[model samples]
Target: MGTIVKQNKQLYKAISENKRFSLAIFICFMAILKIQYSNVESTEYLGIADTKEININSSHSVKIRNIHVIPGQTVEEDELLMELERPDLDLRIYELESQLNELKAENSFNSEMNKELKSVKVSNNENMDSPLQIKINSMTKQLIILKRKKADLFVFSKRAGVIGSINVKVGEDASPFTPLITMHDSAPSMIKGFIHESIYNKTYKGQKVVVTSISDPNKIMDAVVASVGNRIVEYPVRLRKSEASVTYGREVVIFVSKDNPFLIGEKVQIKSFEKPNEIMTAHAQAVPVRKIEDVIDLEIGVDIENTKVEPSGLVYIKDLNQTVMISDDTGRKDRPYIYTVNNSGLIDKEIEIEGVKAISDMEAISMDENGIIYIASSMSEKKNGKVSDKRKKLLMIERNDFNFKAIGEVNFYDALNKVAKSNKSEEWAQVLLAKGNKKIRINIEGILVKENTMYFGLRSGSKLTKDQFVLLKINDIKSVFAKNAIDADQISIQANVAFPIDSDFKNEGVSDIALINGELYVLTVNNTGKEGGRVLKTVLADPSNHMTELKRFKGLKPEGITYDTSASKFLISFDQGDKKSKLLLVDKF
Candidate 1:
């Protein structure tokens, strides 16, 4: 009986040992298995790295109608590269030239007549200074201008190089604002590679890069990183098993020796790649803050000329077929500033309206469907970002034939202050070292009337947190007015829109706002002067969504943007400061 019991105990111990050994083997196998290993480290990209090149760009939108040279063709200095077709511009040039020739012929005749008069000793000095002489001088000036315009119709190469690449073909609309062709010199070839994202942070300009021929790993060359791209793009050639996400990388150009044997756009391997010591990235650089003024100049562009003062507001009245521009100057008897400009680029007339109180500084103007012109003055002192101790100004006008007469007036200070006080402005959110000394004042820079609602644009807001904008609904505007005066605080206001501080462009909130083709376009300028501003657009259906980039402005301080259906482009006005204010018409992107 004892021996049988001992045998049972031995069987139990052997079974326990076998179970523990099996569990240990299973655990060891599981430890060696890879569940979520990343292939980002092993990825490589194929890119063009050969030839010294130059990208020829167009500064304006134009249609390419002629290609003078093909790729691989050699070109000389001042050689014709491409011809842009601008039918309207060409027509204008022809007209100007024709008018100039006619003037020159008349001037010649007048000169002969004057010589004949001198020979006859005609004593009348008045005859010598007749309108013909004046006209002759004007025509000579016009001829010189017409000749310059005629010469600008063609594009020419500044430096001689081979046509490496052509981005445009025959009879296509091409915007010369971007690179249209590449001209490359016969210099030593270089290598360009798209670094894997996992190792992208380790790359930088002036860093060492190892290049090895993919076909033969033994052939290798040491190079330096020449440039790092700011944009992410797809690999030109896809590897056999590269995933879609890993296929995208920042283009990196490397410097190669003159005798390098790598073909232009060849595949190569980079060795000894290590993660970067530190990675630096930013949405945008912070710029300097500007001083605030009582009257912010909302420079609205118009097709008008010979105005006495700077234009602050603009409105296009369809019924009268006229565009109205108002001055940023104080309404005084001496400075008559309200003007009506015809679409033909002529200042048709000026309107004189008597003010009940004061129209010192009008910053924005818009026309309603009922032919009523709405005018608004800036409420915040931009330097201090403070609301004015006085009332904000608002005015409405109705044009009778060519006469623009005032229809109503309002004090908007209370309403603007109320909206500003509700939120804390994030002025320092973008600046590196600026003191937040003043409260963010809701400065209404622009106004739009849509579906019985008024959307006021706040030009000041901290980025990443709250961007500034407001929507107000006014019921029975005419009924709300009493004796040509109204209180904007009494209107029914909707929730205001404030952008968060996390946007790529954390510049000053917005300079102006415009509704174009069902999208709201907001213009922002760098207050800290760290980076150029951006024109952002958002769909009306979802204004809460982050606005996407539409246009970018650098050096050119754009004050306002408006869409012209007649031209199908955006007209941007720049602050000339004290110089002649200018307007630029850019293609909408």
Candidate 2:
């Protein structure tokens, strides 16, 4: 009986041991399964703190006639903050109305005549004249005039919002096409932020975002990604604030949802995830506090799945161990280089420059010899060619040898006609003539001649000799033949005469000719102490015939003229009394 009892106890013990073993195996398998699932789901997401901004003003430009509201003033919707006056446009409209009235009167008369002919059953030449037609024409003319007048009185609401700026005053003549006032729209606010083009692919719409207003510290606004633009430059991001939220970029709109109101044009803090809620694994130091570009001298580990963060620095990653941070040892000007530890636990490799940033730390995109990395500096340098002094000034005439001399005394009328003909082609000549003659004896005679011609010369010579006849018509005379003379048949000619025109004179004496937009422009100023200035334009073919005075601005005793080819305009700087210089831009003609 004892042996049987002992055998039963042993069987029970064996059964209990088997059950405990099975439980232990099951728990071990579950633990392995949990670790595998965690590994598959685990990920690290790089996040950046973005500022939410609002653009209060609709247009990029504005002309202020008056600033009705101050910077801190709170404004309501559709409020009249300022007024704009367009005087020139008003006059133009009145002229158009008058012409419309005449056309309408003529049309009314024709309609009445046609109606009368239709009413009359009998068609006859004697009944052609209809009194009704005359009355109908007059009424039609009046209606046409009224319609034309209505078209001229045009006005635009600068913009629909609170007034931000008013630059002009009442009774002041505002230049056309200039802005008068700026308006800020309170509704539909957006946030503006700049991101690199490399990381743009990772960002998408419908991503959840937490926005905290800068002006109202306690308010947290919930929003989502709106629309993204196709342009790659530093772009503006707009966040459609929830209802009752204040505008972000402007100063007039305010929100009362939180304890404090959100100021217009104020920046707000924002946090968003690039992907759906995933197990994020990131070091406390890896996440940038301000912006990714602002970080420097920090090591980072990133996942291998996220290609955007591949090779890392403002990129997306999938696994942590695949990425390793290294020290940046490359010089600033040289290629950006990074030192990485090898399998032997020694720093063995260096990387070249990969990219760069303005707001962020410099990124090494490539490398060079000696395992050095090159990073792009923040400044952008450009090279340009130097301008030669010879090209700045225009050349009028080449050096040449020419002479002029008169054979005998010429009459006042004849001399004057010769001078005018010589200046026909924009060229002037030096006139030379004999002034007086000296008698050596009955057989020999000597003569003295004056050769240079002044800009303004009198026909009558105040200084001349009695016996020496002044000849003004001589075009050329040989030096050998006129060395010394006297034969009754050979007339004594004047000597060589030359006058050099100074083309280098800039102020008060320089004149310029320009061809702009297929029109000839002649700029001339009277440096003779006359306050006269003229700007003329004409066809190149017939400059003298159809010369039109485009601009007759009178101010400076004019001196020099220059035309800027790039601007397609001319500038005339005048010396107004006391060395004060005035520059006028001639745009038309």
Weakest ten-residue segment in model 2 by summed lDDT: 439-448
Candidate 2 to truth, TM: 0.27
Best by TM-score: 1
lDDT tens string, model 1, 1-589?
9999999999999999999999999987776544322211222444444666778766556777888899999897679988776665667667777876786678677667867775665445654466765665676666565555446658787555678889888778876566788987444356767776666766665444567777766656655565688887777644424454446778887766545666655577754333333211111222221122111223222211223455555565555645566556543322334765333223335455534335545566766666676777766564555444332666667767876666666666553334334432422212111134223334556676665456666554332223454444454455434433334343543335555444555545566666777787777655564435567788654566766776676665555666566645566655454665545555556
Name model 2 segments beyond 4 Å from true.
1-78, 81-89, 96-160, 173-177, 195-201, 214-217, 227-261, 275-589
Counted clashes in each candidate structure: 23, 52
Error of 2 at 207 (Å): 2.7
Q: Estimate every model's Cα lDDT from 0 to 1.
A: 0.57, 0.33
The sequence of per-residue lDDT tens digits that candidate 2 reaches over residues 221-327 is 54333334466642234433444543232111111211223444556654444433332221111222222112111111111111111121110011211111111
lDDT leader: 1
Error of 1 at 539 (Å): 2.8
